[model samples]
Target: MKELRYLNKYFKKYWFKLLIGIIITIIARVFSLVLPPYVNKSIRAVEGYVASGSGDLSAVKGELLEYILIILGAALLSGFFTFLMRQTIINVSRYIEYDLKNEIYDHYQRLNLGFYKQNRTGDLMNRISEDVNQVRLYCGPAIMYSIQTLTLFFCLVPIMFIKAPTLALYTLLPLPILSVLIYRISRVIHKRSTIVQQFLSTLSTFTQESFSGISVIKAYGLEPKTNANLQTLAIEGKDKSMDLARVNAWFSPLMILLIGISNIFVIYIGGKQYIDGQIESMGIIAEFIIYVNMLTWPVAVVGWLTSIVQRAEASQKRINEFLHVQPEIKNEIDKDTPIAGRIEFKNVTFTYPDTNITALRNISFTVKEGETVAFIGRIGSGKSTILDLVARLYDINSGELLIDGMPIKKLNLKNLRGAIGAVPQDAFLFSDTISNNIRFGKENASMEEIVTMAKKAVVHENITGFTKGYDTVLGERGITLSGGQKQRVSIARALLKDPQIYLFDDCLSAVDTETEEEILNNLKQASKNKTTLIVSHRVSSAKNADKIIVLEDGQILQEGTHDQLVGREGYYKELYQHQLSEN
Candidate 1:
């Protein structure tokens, strides 16, 4: 019910369409109800005339033909209204589905990276697809039919009571039993449907993860293991789906049984009343039977409609939970002056959400405009976190981070991020043409500009070797490209930005030393008069930096020029000596 309240906005937004649909549905039901009463009158006329021994056969024939025309007209009108009802209401549902999906996707885009890390991609996809369809079922057909059922009951009930009160009362004797069955079956259906949806999400997540890491599984020859795990998930999903189906299966039979019981009562009571002369012509009995039959479809469909409502409630709650999440990072309006490529961290500290341990602790450093600073650290030394903070992927928990002498939190997020170009360690690339991937850094970048940046990153030759050159579409995550090619493409993408500052998180890790040196030299030449930060584990990569900062255990252990650090007896010196010994 609470989740339904959240949907009021959509209903209100399209109230006119819903109202038109409802009106048409009511009109359709009214047309259906008119036939039974007219049918009673025509039968009574024929019966009375026959009982009187009148030879007015022509009159009876004329009346019968007129009755046929009326019934035909009613049926045609009913069908048209039904079509209109479906067109209006179902179209509203489609529109609402479009709106809801777009809203969710937009919110997903605004949410911080932490939210993505905490949730599975498959679970989110399921909510957007399967859960939305469930909700649409409730919004359209379920609601439409429910209203139709109630309308048929109200309009037809009094007509039945007028035709034969006692028989009508007897016909309703099965209602309480029917109510109990509906309640029980609906509860089970709702519960089982929820379990089925959850298991489906689990199956989706497992399949997605397996496909994404297929290469790793194949490399380790763990195909059998992966298949077994997938089989287990499939079985779990199938079992839950079967449980839901079983609950729903009982509904149709239960509805038929209830309707059958009511019909038995009508036959017995109406026949006895007429035999005892307590009732009038047989037409009344015929009318009563027609009214009871009218109740059949609605009563039979109650279980299905209830199942739809229950499933919708379940899905709405899940969707509501996702929509209500508050983003961890909030962007502010622009007020700070233009960026000067100078970055400073003053006593900054950060701990991830839901964790007690700090990832960065009281770390402070400054890089002046046009300076190239490199952070060299072992794994888990927080080198990447520093770069992440500079990009505002995650906000610092304490102290201040500034660019161009203004606190970063005060700077406009879009402008701040636009000023810094980053090539992450993963070197992620979307499924697009190689040229398009490079142009992502600058949306309006020309082909010539893209080629220039590609040459600077030393990936131009690779592009020329491909059959489609810049037009070749990449596979997921650029799996079609080698590791070195991916890294260079990422670097080229970043280089195309030509930002005030550049952040490279081991972007050249996959390339050979000579190639790395060549690319770095080109980067140095291209990035003149701009700030640069490189997070690297390789001493060879950091050896030519204007300044080197060595981090250990989330704290700065050393800061000096490359030559100065090599002369010191600390972690930096030890790392340099170890690399020298290895060489």
Candidate 2:
């Protein structure tokens, strides 16, 4: 019932079509029921003709022909209505599936970054693809067949009782018992099917992770380990599938037993009625046999429909859960005003969800308009966390982040993000032409502007040297480019944005010292008036900053000009000496 309510929105949209389909299905079943009676009537007509020795052959032939025509007409009507019902249901199912998939995708886009951080990519994929498909399958055939089964059962059961009440009662004796057994089996199947789906989701997650990290695995020489892990997941998935199949295996035989038992009872009762002269004609007995056979489908369909309902219910729960997850960060405050580039972190503290220790404790900082600030820190020192907070990727646990004296939470997210440009470590690129990748930051950037930004990043000459130049197609994640080249492209993209605040989070680390120096020189010129923040482990990278802050253990240990920090002879001086020694 919960699953039904979850899917009610889709049902409402397609209810009219479903109603039409149901009508057609009922019509088809009615016509199908009419055929058996016509068959029996035709047989009786033939027998009557044989009983009269001095036969009026033409009258008997006419009667027989009339019954044959009725049977043929009923069959034609059944086929036509059945076809219409199937087409309508199929069309509705496809439309609903398409809408559901797109809604899920749109919801995913609206979710905050923290959601992606916690959820597996493959699991989400399975929900949108496999789980949605399961729902679609249920919506179409399972729904249509269920309606057909009910229609047939209700329409035929009364006719059977009217034709031979004793026999009908005897045949129906096993029905309640069959219902109980099917209900129990359905519960078991539902439980097992849910487990099977979960295992498949886990398998999907593992496979996706392995593929995405294939390069890392090879670099670390862990291919054998990855393969073994994948094999283990595959075996688990197989075992779950086999377990579900085992349940299904028992299900069919039980259905056959129920059907067989019903048929045996009918045969016994009908035979006794014929012997006692309570019923007439072998033809009528044959017609009852046909009606009993027709009932078999409705009985068997109960099990099948139950199975589909269970699977769809399981899928619905997963999809609903995904849809219900509130993003960690959301724009709850109203925003009707514009903002300037000035930013401040006032007594802000943050602890990642599901953790006891705080990542950022009592942190406060400010960046004035058109100022350059550098953050020097070792790994895991909360430098990235500060940058993420400024971007509103994660919200602060306490205090406020303000842009241009206004709380950032009150500003429109799109407007806030539009004013910031970020270049992180391990730059990402799509499998597209170099030109398009650079144009990503500013969608409407002219070709000339793109080339100009590339030149500023010191990558124009390298790109133009290639045979295809700016039109050269890069591989996934720009695997075709060298590390330095990838970083330069990333920088060019950021530069194209022409944002007020530029964030360079170890963006220059991949390049050699000489290339880094050239790019930084160009960046210094390009960012002459814009506020910029550089996060670097190398002291040389922060040497030219107007203000440098040294971070350790999520705290600012020191802040001063480059010369002042080195003169202090603290952690900054030791880092500087180490880099100088390495050089």
Candidate 3:
């Protein structure tokens, strides 16, 4: 019922079309019902004309012609109505699917990063693709077929009773039995189909993970192992599908049994009536047979609709769950206010959802405008967490973070994000031309500006060396580029944004020393009038910063200029010495 209600939102928007389609279907069914009786009446009239020895041919021919015309008219009406009904259903289904897909996509964009982190890309794809498709199936043929079945049954059953009450009652003896069988089989089908869908989601997830991580698998020589795992998932998916098929196989035979029993009962009773003269003609028996045969579709639809409903229910639940998950970071109250990039953390703390321990505890720092600040720490030292907090990726658990003297909780998220530019460690790239990827940061940026930024990041020469230059299509995640090239492209993207506050989180780690130096020189020149924060492992990366803060276990242990930190003989000094020794 909940699933049906959920589907009704889309249906209601097209309800008028659906209602007209259903009305047309009812008209078609009515025309269909009139056919058997017309044939029966015409046959009886023909019999009477033959029985009477003095029957005039001209008088009988007119009646015969009238019957033929009525039959033709009914057939034509049924055909036209059926066509309109089908067209309406198709239009409604297509429109509903369009709206649903757009809604899901828009919802996804509004979701926070944490929601994406917990969800598998393949599972999300299945919800958008497979699950929505199931819903569409229900919306289109399943809905149309269901309406047609009920309308046919209602129109035929009452007519059956009026024609021969006793015979109609006797003929329907197998219906209850059929209903029980259908109910049981439907339950089994629903259970198995749910399992099948879940297994399919798992299979999709495995395939997506394998393809996305193919390079890593090859690098580690784990292809055979990965292949074995995928084969196992495929086998499991196959088994579930077969099991659902096995359940569905029982449905057709049961329908056949019930339909056959109904036919046999109708023949026995109608034959006796004909012999005893209670029924007047063979045409009446023929008509009854046709009417009984019509019952076949409604009964068969019962089984088929059961499967559609089950699949749609499962899909609805999955989509609803995704839509219901609350974002970890909610938008702030002041949604349009701008900030000047003066950031301060006042005893801010945070813990990830479903975790006991804090990732950042009582962390505090401040960066004034036009200052180049550096955060140095070992792995798992919450350096990245600081950057994430500043970017509003996660909300603080206690205390406050302020930008330009306004609480970050009160600053507009879009404005805050728009004012900051970040180059992350992983250096993610889209499967697009180099120029387009850089333009992602600033959509309306000209080609000339993109080239300038690329040159500043030391990637312009490399990009121009390709056959297509800036138009060269990169592979997924820039797989065609070297690590350093990918890193420089990411830097170029950030630099192109020309935001007020720039964040480089270990952005120079993958490049050679000389290239890193050149990039740093460019960054220094570019960031002279803007506030920049760099998180780096190498001392050289932070050596020229106006202020360097050494973070250990989410707490700032020391803060000073490069010369002071190097001379202080603390964590920063030790890190500097270690890097110099390695070089």
Task: For candidate 2, give the lDDT.
Answer: 0.86
User: Candidate 3, TM-score vs. the true structure?
Assistant: 0.93
* Tens-place lDDT digits, model 1, residues 228-289: 99898888788888888888888888888888888888778888998999987677777777
List ranges where model 1 is wrong by over 4 Å: 52-54, 334-340, 566-570, 573-583
Estimate the overall C-alpha local distance difference test score of candidate 1.
0.88
- Say which candidate scores most in lDDT: 1
Off by over 4 Å in 2: 1-4, 54-66, 110-114, 334-337, 431-436, 444-451, 460-480, 525-529, 563-568, 573-583
CA lDDT of each candidate?
0.88, 0.86, 0.86
Output the lDDT of residue 411, model 1.
Answer: 84
Candidate rank order under TM-score = 3, 1, 2
- In model 3, the worst 10-residue window by lDDT is 326-335
- Clash counts per candidate, in order, are 0, 0, 0
lDDT of 1 at 212: 84
Candidate rank order under lDDT: 1, 3, 2
TM-score of each: 0.92, 0.90, 0.93
